[model samples]
Target: MPCTQKVTDDIVWVGGSDRRLALFENVFPLPDGISYNAYVILDEKTALMDTADAAIAERFLTNVEGALAGRKLDYLVVNHMEPDHCAMIGEIVRRYPEIKLVGNTKTFRFMEQFFDFPLQDRCITVKEGDTLTLGRHLLHFVMAPMVHWPEVMMSYDSTDKILFSADAFGTFGAFHGPIFADQINFQVRYVDEARRYYTNIVGKYGPQVQAVLKKATGLDIAILCPLHGPIWRKDLGWILDKYDKWSRYEPEEKGVVIAYGSMYGNTEAAAEELANLLAQKGVTALRLYDVSKTDSSYLISDLFRFSNFVLAAPTYNNGVYLPMNALLHDIAALNLQNRQYSLISNGSWAPISGKKMDEALNKLKGMQQVGETVQFRSSLKAEQLPQLKALAQAICDSLK
Candidate 1:
């Protein structure tokens, strides 16, 4: 249903929509659904970009058939080897018997591993900057290694000047009713999805992304056609700008994000006290978010905006609290740098959380520790004002 969206004169979006959420892998616990996007470029010779995941293979083929009418598919380019994007390759090859599967060596290697080398007979290996002609359309394949996967490359249509990025600009959530960047409030969804995608999938490959960006520097790109989400025909620089900022591991602003999850009122009070103290010290963008109530997106947004972080959690069986641990597991994927932080922990008897946090924070590069962390046995009482003030003062000093 979403394939009917217009991208350019010759390019059409033939992607698949996700009807049910928590269906990404049919295993992971996902509240929001995912979309598998594929495109068909009807040039003088028809070229259908990557096929959608197996779940939507039939619909994806339908859309392609609709676009081609009776025209034969000349090329089926495989950018990523991920099952979600590559599962329908065998079927596509079966339907379009004469279509050539274009990809780099790594792509074909993965193709062999997946479909048992049966489809390998129709494969075409391409290197970086390799050009393939489909009728009058000239497609240049740029090798994009480790943007998220090893066997990934992007195809550029010279005639239409459209960059068919494999998964570089993909995000979560489905686009069923509305398509295109201008059709919906992209900010509401894309911002969070981008952070999640980058942190989880693409954050580790910053240098490779930079390489792709550098390779694309001289090209005259009018539209960026990614494998997922609504097509970008307007404000193309917006997503690229976001990639630049995120890839640099840059935080949004100079502030502190005090996120905590507490079982009782003890941790909450400490967080509140620290928040007030930071506010009193003229920290403009200070925010205290409860991880139990807030979604991962808001947490990521706060983490993105602030340079300094402070966390409070109670120890559970020598480990951190569930919500706090969950947040840490999520943040570990970010791999952020130049971050200044402090900690507060509660154990009642055994105080392992403070040291655990210390080790965890130390593993993070460029994470500057301000001062001694404040460990509370039960709660902050009347006598710990000096300690609390010192903690606040240390955080304030780190901000400078």
Candidate 2:
């Protein structure tokens, strides 16, 4: 039996979810699994938007067949060349030999590199602003190069006012029931996973995302059908505004995030003291995490959400802690900017993690330090309470 849902009068969602996979891309942990989306449009000439992962190949093909309902498939549009969405391309071609594969020039090149299937003049190459007509519907191709992939593109349906975004507005978690964002409590259920997905996977290409967003402003888009997560039919402005802010590397809230890498609980204790002080000074929007315990993806997501952050770690072998070092590298590699940060370092003999951390953060574009570096020898001394209080005050002032 195929599990398919109606997207519109002429469009049907043939995507499925994979909840058994522990990690996404073999790197980021997927606590609730992930979803892969593909759509089938039943027009005069039936067309498939994309393909799903090989993990769910049987179910995906069944859904596509059910949606087609004995109609011959005419086209298979390839918006992204990533394997997660393109893994079943060869299978799709084999199943529907008469189907024409639609994509850009680079998309064909990547397809040739990935699969050994014979094309035999079954390719329909399109360029930016190219339009493909299917009876009453028209698809306008918009080039979105380097929006996480060099061959990524988007298709805008002039008839239905729908944008088939490749992975631009994708999220992580798999859907349990509803497929529309308005049908569920999206903010409380999936916002964190959405932020984590963008910040970790596609966060490095902010400028490219900005370019795509600018191109999108010209089209009157009513529905957003991404490669993952729920489709957007209502409150589209909320998600669009979030992408704008995130692409510009701007914070969403005036709050602080405290991340600590503690070996023997000293650095953790210091981080808690600072959090306490910040809360006492009316800084309520705060998040505290253990870098050694929590994944770097979540930390990066929170840092992107908040305006201020505090990093506290213990010196190890004359360098910053191992977990904290990795976190700092990710922050820099992601091109995060315009953030305010504070530092705390602890060492029994030589406390130099603060200096190392400063050097790491200084390499970024618009990172600003809010308070003096607080150094402690293995523990927070009685006299160091004043230093923590002063740092809290400084952070509070900067927030105002």
Candidate 3:
């Protein structure tokens, strides 16, 4: 049985979710799984927007076929050339031999590299501001290069005021039943996953995202049809605001995210003590993560979310702990900036992890150190409690 949902009177969602996949892009962990979203427009000349992952290829094809209902697929829009969305492009061309593939020059360039299929005469090349009419609907092409991918582009439907965003407003969660953002508690359930998805996958392309957001400001968008996760038909500003802030490297909330690396729970104890002190000082939105246990993707997400950060780690062979070092390098690699951070380092022999951590953070842009670096000799002794309390007070003052 084919499962599908209607987005509008003439547009139907022909996407499917893959809950079995453990990781996305073979790097980011997907505990809630992920969704591969595609859409079909029923007009005089039918059009299909993107395709699903190969893991769900069979089920996705069934949904597309069911949605088409024997009608010919005249147009297949290639929004992003990423394999998750473009894996079945060859299969699509094989099924709809006469369907005109719509994409930009870069899109076709990547297509040839990814697939062996001959696309010489099958592709209809489009550029920025190019419009394609399919009966009552008109799609305006918008170039969004480097918005996570070089071949990424967006199609705007003037008829229904819908923006076929390639991957801008996407999240990392499988769709259970509802296919729209308004149908579920998006903020409570999907925001973290969405943040993780953006910060890890598309966070490095902040300037490109800002360029696309600037382009979108002139157009009137009522529905956001992304290549993954749920569709946006209501409270569009909620997600747009987040994108605006994230792309500009601005924190969404004034809070703290304490991430620590502990070999035998000493560093974690210090982190917990600071967290408790902050809580007692009325700091409510504190997030603490064990860097050894928690995935770096989630930490990166919180790093983008909160304005303040605290890193706790121990020295290993005169260097920063392995997991904490990895996290710090990940932060610098992502070009994270404009945030305040504090450090706590523990070592039985050499207490240089705090300085090492500070050096790692110094490589990033706009990273400000809060108070003094708290150093502990393997454990938080009574003497260091005052120093930890003072550091927590400094973090709280910065938040205020």
Best model number under TM-score: 2
lDDT of 3 at 170: 97
The global Cα lDDT (0 to 1) of model 2 is: 0.94
Clashing pairs in 3: none
lDDT agreement with native, every candidate? 0.79, 0.94, 0.94
Which stretches of candidate 3 lie above 4 Å from their native place? none
List candidate 2 stretches off by more than 4 Å: none
Indicate the worst ten consecutive residues by lDDT in candidate 1: 23-32
**Cα lDDT, model 3, residue 181:** 94
Ranking by lDDT: 2, 3, 1
Model 3 scores a C-alpha lDDT of 0.94
For candidate 3, lDDT tens digit of each residue in 1-400?
A: 7899999999999999888999899999999899999999999999999998999999999999999999999999999999999999999999999999999999999999999988878989999999999999999999999988888999999999999999999999999899999999899999999999999999988899999999999999999999988899999999999999998889999999999999998889999999999999999999999998999999999999999999999999899999999998889878799999999989998989999989988887889999899998989999889999999989988997
Candidate 2 residue pairs in backbone clash: none
Please report how far candidate 2 places residue 273 from its true position, in Å.
0.6
Model 1 residue 205 CA deviation (Å) reads 2.0
